[model samples]
Every structure is written in structure tokens, then in C-alpha cells.
Target: MERNLELTIRMDNDHVEIDVYEPESGECSQIDAPLSFDEHPEFDAAVGNEIYSWLSLWADELAGQN
Candidate 1:
């Protein structure tokens, strides 16, 4: 089944966090080394490249909001 993903991002001056959740199925992928989003390859590529990609992507988004 194709479900819309929900991302919860929390960050501060010293830390960055990205979390993925498929609410319908309750599958969650949190901020951890080698973050896994196998069930959802879309995000697997978005934030899969270590913490670099994860923070980079969201950092861009957050910056744009300002």
C-alpha cells in the first residue's frame, strides 16, 4: 500500500534529528547511524546518506522558511 509519509524533524544549534513514520502502519525510522528507510525508498534516498544528507536537506528547507 502507498502511504503518505510523515517526517518529524527536530534540530538545535548542536544537533539534528530526522524521523520518518508511516502512520497507517506505524512503521518508524528514527535518527540513527545508517538510517534506514527501506520500506520507503523515497526517503531512503532523501536522508539516507549518513547525517549529511538528512541535515542538508532539512537545513535547506528550514533556511527557506526564514
Candidate 2:
């Protein structure tokens, strides 16, 4: 079986929100926090790494179930 995963990122002046959706199972996960862009130049890369880690862990758990 194949699993479908979707990721969405939304940012505003005060914070950044990251949402993960598994459409096949209607499971959703999110990560959000206050961000100061001027203070942290590595914000984008850091957040990207976090999301990738979440996806990898989710995938591994799903694979183990099968």
C-alpha cells in the first residue's frame, strides 16, 4: 500500500506554522513557533530540517506497522 503525505508551511510577522497531512488516514500534525527573522538568518534551513525529520519518523512508523 502507498501512503500520501502533504506538507504546508505558512508564515506571518510573528510566527511560522508547519502542517503535515496524511490524506489516506486523515491524520494531521503541526509545528508552530514564534520566529524572529532578523535575529536568525538560518531560520529557513532549520525549519526545513525539522519538517524533514518529522516526515522521516512518520514514514518509519508507518512502515513498521506493515
Most accurate candidate by lDDT: 2
Cα lDDT tens digits, model 2, 1-66, are 445668898999888887878786687777676777567656666668766876787789888999
TM-score of every prediction relative to native: 0.44, 0.47
How much does candidate 1 score in TM-score?
Answer: 0.44
Each model's total of backbone clashes: 0, 0
Summarize candidate 1's per-residue lDDT along 1-66 as a digit string, tens digits: 123568888766544477877666586777633334345464455565544644565577678989
Query: Which 10-residue span in candidate 1 carries the lowest summed lDDT?
Result: 32-41
Predicted candidate 1, C-alpha RMSD:
13.9
Span of ten consecutive residues with least summed lDDT in model 2:
37-46
